[model samples]
Target chain A: GESVGLHLPTLSVQEGDNSIINCAYSNSASDYFIWYKQESGKGPQFIIDIRSNMDKRQGQRVTVLLNKTVKHLSLQIAATQPGDSAVYFCAENRNFNKFYFGSGTKLNVKP
Target chain B: GAGVSQTPSNKVTEKGKYVELRCDPISGHTALYWYRQSLGQGPEFLIYFQGTGAADDSGLPNDRFFAVRPEGSVSTLKIQRTERGDSAVYLCASSPLAGTDTQYFGPGTRLTVL
Candidate 1:
């Protein structure tokens, strides 16, 4: 079945440095994409989202980039903080029905 | 404004037992969704409701799993004859509307089937 997947399982970055997590999705029909952050024992928290019509979207210290042609998505966190340590997931939505999530990438910010 | 909320943050059940997980979505949101997250994996779609009717349920694994939103504000996910594989974090989310809306998630209900 077509699904969303991440390029790496874990990413470690030093505090105050930039961090980028990558994801790959197989469904071309997907038009909306979102990035979520989940800490231990917590549900996913919405970070940022982007539409297929746009290539990039930015929020507070976070940016989401989408490449429809390559079926790729990326989340960039500026000046990574220790509080940013968590599992990040990318979700793709098609036709506003359901969203498929990737396995997730664990971001470890070293203090 | 309150965010999504799920009851009984954690549950432990034996095999073949029945369990129900509840979700209270954000006020005035018409779209609700449920997902299951297993260990080392992201959340997997289970079902979605547009108002009081199920708009999509293709993600449900089998017949034993069912969900309902009677008044379109709250939803309950029922699992009959639960199996060990059913153990996971059940997450509920809600969006203001269907198309291009961002979903806000609950704290989740972690169910452990032994």
Candidate 2:
């Protein structure tokens, strides 16, 4: 089975506001989770990541949360800007050897 | 180079034709992976090579798809008798080692099977 998926296909946020994108994973054994941002016609760019041992991790203006019990993950962006508009993807990493990427959510920042 | 690279950015071929996608990983990276992504979908795993041997080929969809990383630096994904359903963006990634989850990805090769 595929490991990760998103509940929302598209999200819009007012510029300067905060944005949150949610993801659900099927694999209970996945220990590491990562969030990526991909612009049009470009590959995914790493945003932030969190391990199973930590519930949350922060990087720049992005934050990642991991819930082991629910197998859920989320990426939060503070002070969202117009430049933040892109497709957001969440990936699951298990066994530290394999990764499964989730269907991305397109986030639009309204100016 | 410091980043992964893929060649033949776009390819158009008829059904039953053969195709090969190439990838060059970052210098000294030992783990290379292949993935396929269709329109409006996430990338799907295909195969992985650690050093000269494939460590995981379980994700390969069928026997028609084959990949090789002979020297552990440059890798190739080969498809035979390509079908329309085989059209996708072939992506390649490389990590320092298989044990590290952080992988750097290339721009990918867009394959169109008609």
Candidate with top lDDT is 1
DockQ of the two-chain complex in candidate 1: 0.85
**Model 2: what TM-score?**
0.96
TM-score of each: 0.98, 0.96
Worst 10 residues of 1 chain A by lDDT: A92-101
TM-score of chain B of each: 0.98, 0.97
DockQ of every predicted complex: 0.85, 0.68
**TM-scores of the first chain across all predictions?**
0.97, 0.95
> Where in model 1 is the C-alpha error above 4 Å?
none
lDDT of 1 by residue, B28-64 (tens): 9999999999999999989999999999899999999
Candidate 1 per-residue lDDT over residues A1-111, each given as its tens digit:
888999999999999999999999988999999999999999999999998999999999999999889999999999999999999999999757788889999999999
Clashing pairs in 1: none
Per-residue lDDT over B1-114 for candidate 2, one digit per residue giving the tens place of the 0 to 100 score: 568899889999999999999999989889999999888988888889999899999999999999999988999999999999999899999988886568888889999999
Error of 1 at A60 (Å): 1.2
Clashing pairs in 2: none
